[model samples]
Target: MDTRRLTQYVICVCVILTTVTLAQGQIKRCFACRSRGALGDCKDPFRFNSTHLVPGVKDEPCASGWCSKRIEGKKDGKDHDLAIERQCLQRSPPDDKERCSEALVGHRKIFICFCYGDLCNSASGIKPSFLLLFIPLAFQMLSSRF
Candidate 1:
């Protein structure tokens, strides 16, 4: 192979390898928050009550302690905030609802799956927020490459 061509090939290979390895593999935790401070994650996001997010949306947040998932995807956090806020109302104290509503939208998405009254967002691969994470990453990676 030509020397210059070989180097170019090598670089291309490196880039592909690196990018592919990180290509949206299911993390043991939420892709957004990665279970760092999250109480848990929602593995399956849609099983909840479609009418009520906390019940319909997977990995919704806890009452006062932690939000089911976090948001840091490509979508503007501001946008998802509206949806999260609407869902946040389902919780106990309806006071700080506005800001609490902002947790699930933006360049991120998290869903903590809990079984019986526990943090569910950071649970693991089963969380649906993981899907949103990849959806944007797919778009982002494509855009940057293009």
Candidate 2:
């Protein structure tokens, strides 16, 4: 094959491989769990250790490429309870970002966070380490061709 054609073929292959790798990276696995009160593993101060052994919490893929955690505080006449949820999102929220935001639902207060990293909706919040780790690998692959 001619030099020009060989170079073009290599570039094309690299592009295709990169695209596939990036697409795979977009799908994230997040923790899915919910608890209506403070008695479950899904509640605040979530234990990150040995989560796989937990009965209610499991990892699920997020097709929308986003994971979210919602915490709702409900109050009755003189008692208060907390509802915690962590799951993979099917659709992106309007204010989808890597930060947590608060809102009022009736008399209850809710704090929801949307993130795009694997298991990012954990108790510690967003995890950008995945992207941070990918950038250098991608750059190395591209640079090695030169």
Candidate 3:
């Protein structure tokens, strides 16, 4: 390739990469439920009463973390205790499972766990968030080369 064409190609690749990186750093989604009725009512297969789109923290990437908290306790004295509260946390530890879990603990009779990924704590299953992003990114990368 000629010098000018090569420079253009490099610039194009850089732009594409930058765009993808920025996009990946934003737009995280998590299931949210704060109401007692929603927690008990949205059952069978389990459904989130709603979802939370996390906002970007100052000096941090927007929506880069997904967090869910399930508060488990016993209504009566039985082993069948269930999660009484479930919510999507606004700010969460990023990419650190241990830290997330640790942060969720310290409540009596309440079992809490945190995970990274959209709807990861749902009864259905975890949704593959990266696949959606990568499909378009791969296409862009492939298309740009030609």
The estimated TM-scores of all candidates read: 0.20, 0.60, 0.44
Q: Please, what are the lDDT tens digits per residue for candidate 2 over residues 11-123?
A: 67666666776776777788899887647788767776334438788878778878889987754432236778998888887776577789787886798888887777777
Candidate 1 lDDT at 125 equals 30
Give one digit per residue, the lDDT tens place, for model 1 in 33-107: 221112222322323332333432343343343233333323343333322211222242334231223334355
Evaluate model 2: give its lDDT.
0.73
What are the lDDT figures for the candidates, one per model? 0.34, 0.73, 0.50
For model 1 the local lDDT of residue 33 reads 21
Evaluation by lDDT, superior candidate among 2 and 3: 2
Candidate 1 to truth, TM: 0.20
> Which is superior by lDDT, 1 or 3?
3
**Predictions ranked by lDDT, top down?**
2, 3, 1
lDDT of 3 by residue, 1-146 (tens): 77568657756766677677667646555555433422353222454323422221111222645555565554454434444444456666555662223223555545566766644555565554454456566556556767
**Highest lDDT scorer:** 2
What does the lDDT read for residue 34 in candidate 1? 26
